[model samples]
Target: MSLLDEVKNELAAITDDSSLAKQAQVSTMLRFGGGIQLVKNVPVVFAKLTNRSSAAWLKSSIMEIWGYDVELRKASSTLATGETMEYDLVAVTREGKRLALQCGLLDQRSHEITGIAPAHIQGNIAQVKAAWRGAFLAKGRLSDPGKSSMMEIVCPSVDSVNDLIMAARRLGVTAKPHRVNSSVRVRITDPDVIERMLILMGAHTTAREWSGKRVEGETRGKANRLANFDDANMRRSAKAAVEASQKVRHAFEVLGEDIPENLRAAGQLRLDHGDASLEELGRLADPPITKDAIAGRIRRLLQLATKVEKQRAANAEKN
Candidate 1:
């Protein structure tokens, strides 16, 4: 199963305060998942989901908590890729006075906070958290922590997104919303915020797992950066050593025994330890010297070598 499904399954297993769960579940489904339509002149309320676990949870929760039986239907369609996808649709009729009590719960919630406004919901933090949990089970999705830090919910209504933003603010999480195609998407990018939200949604295990992945990914990224830096420094040092050695050879070819003692020492050290850092090369100097001091001598030798090469070019042109 996908990570999202895993989280949903974890949430589905949580059974406490059936009343609160039902309220939150209904509100969430209404905002993010459910639809109202006429089936043979009778108003029908339904929640359609791609994941069987969520649909089963919704079906079982509605029956177990509210004592209302809902009709469960499965429909399938083939994609352009020739893969067939199955959808679960759970529906209840408005016709039966048998479901009147359940329908009343939905209607009452719809009238009071139909727009997804957390502020409009009566009660304390538990209610707010429950609402968020239900909404997530309905429409929430998370990117793998190893890839990116992203958690988002797609809501069919602007009011629902607004409600989500307000609810997150109450939980001390900063959430933003934007339009995606025909829907509004509320997204959270902070790992800490996502973890907190997941816990609020009753998916504590998933939250901990996500946090561990995030830590591992960050540690790997930092190690890669440090290794690249060391490699770049080594390349720079090797290039400098090669150039110094070439200059030293040219000085000897031109000046022969007249080459300066300091330049000769610098050249020999570089040739012997081409991969060594400047500080390490300096330590091997006779009477040991500072890296800056050795570097100065190397610079002078290159300058002299350049002068000799220019003079030879001028002489060749004259000849």
Candidate 2:
């Protein structure tokens, strides 16, 4: 099963606290997921869904809250893998139109109101949670926990998504909206927020499981980054050591046995350990000198080589 389905099923199993909360859920479901449509001069409220649990939950919420028994109709379609089911929970009678009108889904003449959320549930926290839960049931989708950590809800319009964004603020989470044709998608990319949302939507078990998986993934990513850091440091040290050894050899060619004894000893140490760090070179010194002392000696040696190269260049130009 998909992560979304797992969460939706978990949410479906939860019971609402009050009728107001149930109404709030129904309101968001109608506004965002599905809405009122005129069918042969009758206003019918429908929630077209691929998730069975979500469809069941929405239908039951409408029934439980306002005594509207939404009809469940199943449709089949063929795909590359196999046949799939699209569950459409529809309310076609006077009860259906009443439920739609009560939820502010329809205005008397059934012109099909769009992008408006009911005012009754906005102030209450439980109602807000129910509203979000219903919206998710209608159209929310979540990526697998360890893979992407994205959760999104498809909404009816820009104003419809904005209503959810307002609701999200009450839940202490942030959401962004994107438009796809006439519909909008309310998106949450933060893993922490997604887990929090799952908990608020009454999917506590899935929230905890998702949190654990996200933490594990982040830990693994950090470990890999640390290993890469170490590898880069080693490569940088090796390159520096190789360049230092080359410069020290060139200085010897210019100055011959005329070099200072201490500096020559430091240069020889660098030549012997061309892949070693300066601290390691210092440790290998005859008297166990400090890293700074070894680095200063190498710096002076390279300066001497540079001076000789400049002098040779000027001499050749003069010639």
Candidate 3:
């Protein structure tokens, strides 16, 4: 099944369950698979599963099933000397790599806060610092000479992601936001750890939905062409050319006069010579003019024809 389907199935399983139990299940799953390490002396289960916890659980469950080792950990320290903070989840891979996952649930009460709220801002900073500490510490302890560890922060909403990036700079952690799939999956490499944690906490639910296929080549190609073409300009040019042609014809009709010397000569030359361009018309004229000059004259004549047609329409309306 697809990642989305799996998430749907899991969500359905939890929908009927108690909120407290669901939170514990999610937190435990994140911990067991070594996906996240609980902060020193910090409590794992919060008082109740708020909307944030629900979102966290759903997102974590999808990641767990998708083969990523996910975790939910807290942060131990902060820039404020005595202040300590915790993150919703700290997912890590089997290779000891880590990703900081933060869930921002929109409050139904306040439509103003659609995604990440300003309240969770400080906690996100602490998470970044924790990830950097984990990455470097893991690198230092690595017995092998090659392959240094790295960490990333994953935020569900665009606002949270942007905020975390700025926060990471202040904390001196080189962190980037993890891009989640449309089904709201924050990918990690350690699914087993996350899964085991979930199972231990009784949050192990099956997934129901799947991700959709990407756009096909033919559709993509057409889109690319349209994106590059200057449609507005082409339409304008075509309209101008047509208008010019009509104006020249109208002048001849209105005056009941023979075609102008220039136009008659040009037409004769066109008939005599097959497939001649505007440049050839300019060359054939007594007073040589640029191709652009000839085109301008033609355009004016067409415009005159258009005016005449409009006049004819108005006259019919009056009658």
Clash totals for all models, in order?
0, 0, 27
Instruction: For residues 23-126, write the lDDT of model 3, one tens digit per residue.
Output: 32333223221232244533221211112343365355536533445444443435346765443434333322222232222233423232333433344433
Query: What C-alpha lDDT, on a 0 to 100 scale, does residue 229 get in candidate 2?
Result: 100
Candidates 1 and 3 compared by lDDT, better number: 1
Looking at candidate 1, the ten consecutive residues that score lowest on lDDT are 96-105
Q: Could you tell which candidate, 2 or 3, scores higher by TM-score? A: 2
Would you list the C-alpha lDDT of every candidate in the order shown? 0.74, 0.79, 0.39
Alpha-carbon runs more than 4 Å astray in model 2 = 40-42, 63-96, 108-111, 116-120, 143-150, 169-183, 187-193, 309-319
lDDT winner between 2 and 3, please give it.
2
Q: Write the per-residue lDDT of candidate 2 for residues 26-142, one digit (tens) a residue.
A: 777767666877778876677677788777777777776667666877765566578675566555456667777787787778556666555634658998898888889888888
Which lDDT tens digits does candidate 1 get at residues 175-271? 9997776778999988888888898878999889988988898899889999999999889878977876776677767766766888878877877
CA error at residue 174 for candidate 1, angstroms: 2.6
* Ranking 1 against 2 by TM-score, winner: 1
Top TM-score prediction, candidate number: 1
Full candidate order by TM-score, most accurate first: 1, 2, 3
